[model samples]
Target: MKLGIVITHTDPETVFNTLRLALYSLRQGDSIRIFLSGKGVDIDKIEDPQFDVKGQAQEVLDAGGEFLACGTCLQLRKSGGSQICPISTLKDHYEVVRDSDKLITV
Candidate 1:
């Protein structure tokens, strides 16, 4: 199965949930893609954050899950320096979503 996840919340709890679901999907051998937008982009800037979502994201990447951050959202976050997330355009996100078998937004 192919799954697309859209994360827009900045709250740690929401981020954690997204990561958990992604991990679950990975373990199930399902193809997964994550699109981080809005305040959700902040998650990538936090190094060693208390929630460990970053580590989970890395695990997803290691497991071949597609991880993308909305370019417009990253720009709005002013994450041009080391704080930048994996950059992607809304077009890219749309493509992923369109191609996925399922999509979940949080």
Candidate 2:
């Protein structure tokens, strides 16, 4: 299955759980694309002591799940993006939604 996850917030637990799910899905032989929108573009900056968002995100990447960030959102925050949040476009977002076998939002 091809999965697309649209994350629009910086909530640590939520992002952590979402990446956990992505990692599980990837382990199940599913392809996943995570698109970071709005505050989600700050994924690499999450500092929650309990959730370990960055570590989970890295696990997702290592498990073959891809991450993309809204370029405009990153620009609005004066960010140049990061390894887990590379700059992406609306077109990439659209294609993720349009092509995925399943689409999830959080």
Candidate 3:
């Protein structure tokens, strides 16, 4: 299964859980694409000692999960994006949603 995850929030716990799910899906032999929009592009900055979002995200990436970040959103926040949040466009977002077997928005 190809899973698409569209994230528009910056809440640490939420983002952490989202990444956890992505990792799990990847382990299940599913492909995952995570699109970060709005404040979600700030995922690299989320620092929660308990959640370990960055760690989980890295695990997901290592497990073959992909990530995309809204270019406009990054520009609005003055960010050049990060390893886990590469700059992307609406077309990429649309493709993820269009191609995935399932889509989850958070």
Candidate 4:
């Protein structure tokens, strides 16, 4: 199944839990995609003095789950640098949502 998980919350724990669940789905052989928006874009930024949540996000990426940060959200957050994850337009997210067999939001 194709699963798309959209996370808009800024809390680290919420993002972590969302990715953990997505990771579980990926490990089970499901195609998974993660869309991080709003303050959730912070979850994609990688820098020194990193937290466990950042590490978890990296693990999700390393495990081959599709990770996309909303483009407009990134712009609003002014997080336009190498620190953030790949920026995805709202159009892209809409397509993912449309194609997904299951859609989840956090």
Q: lDDT tens digits, residues 1-106, model 1?
A: 9999888876776777788888898999899888887887787654445787777777778787877888887787677522225788879889888998999999
TM-scores, in order shown? 0.85, 0.98, 0.98, 0.85
Model 1, residue 92: what's the lDDT?
85
Q: Least lDDT summed over 10 consecutive residues: which range in candidate 1?
A: 76-85
- In the range 1-106, model 4's lDDT, one tens digit per residue, is 9999888776766777787888888889898888877767777553434346777776777778887888888888787723336888888788889999999999
The whole-model C-alpha lDDT of candidate 1 against the native structure comes to: 0.79
Rank by lDDT (best first): 2, 3, 1, 4
Cα lDDT of candidate 3 equals: 0.93
RMSD of 3: 0.6
Query: If both were scored by lDDT, which would come out higher, candidate 2 or candidate 3?
Result: 2
lDDT of 3 by residue, 1-106 (tens): 9999999998999999999889989999999999999999998888988899888889988889999999999999998888999999999999999999999999
Candidates sorted on TM-score, descending: 2, 3, 4, 1
Q: Candidate 2, 60: how far from true, in Å?
A: 0.6
lDDT of all predictions: 0.79, 0.95, 0.93, 0.77
What are the candidates' C-alpha RMSDs?
2.4, 0.5, 0.6, 2.8
- Per-residue lDDT of 17-89 in model 2, one digit per residue for the tens? 9999999999999999999999889989999999999999999998888999999999999999988999999
**Whole-model alpha-carbon lDDT for candidate 2:** 0.95
Pairs clashing within candidate 3? none
TM-score of candidate 3 versus the correct structure, residues matched by position = 0.98
Q: Model 2, stretches more than 4 Å misplaced?
A: none
Give the Å shift of residue 98 in candidate 4.
0.4
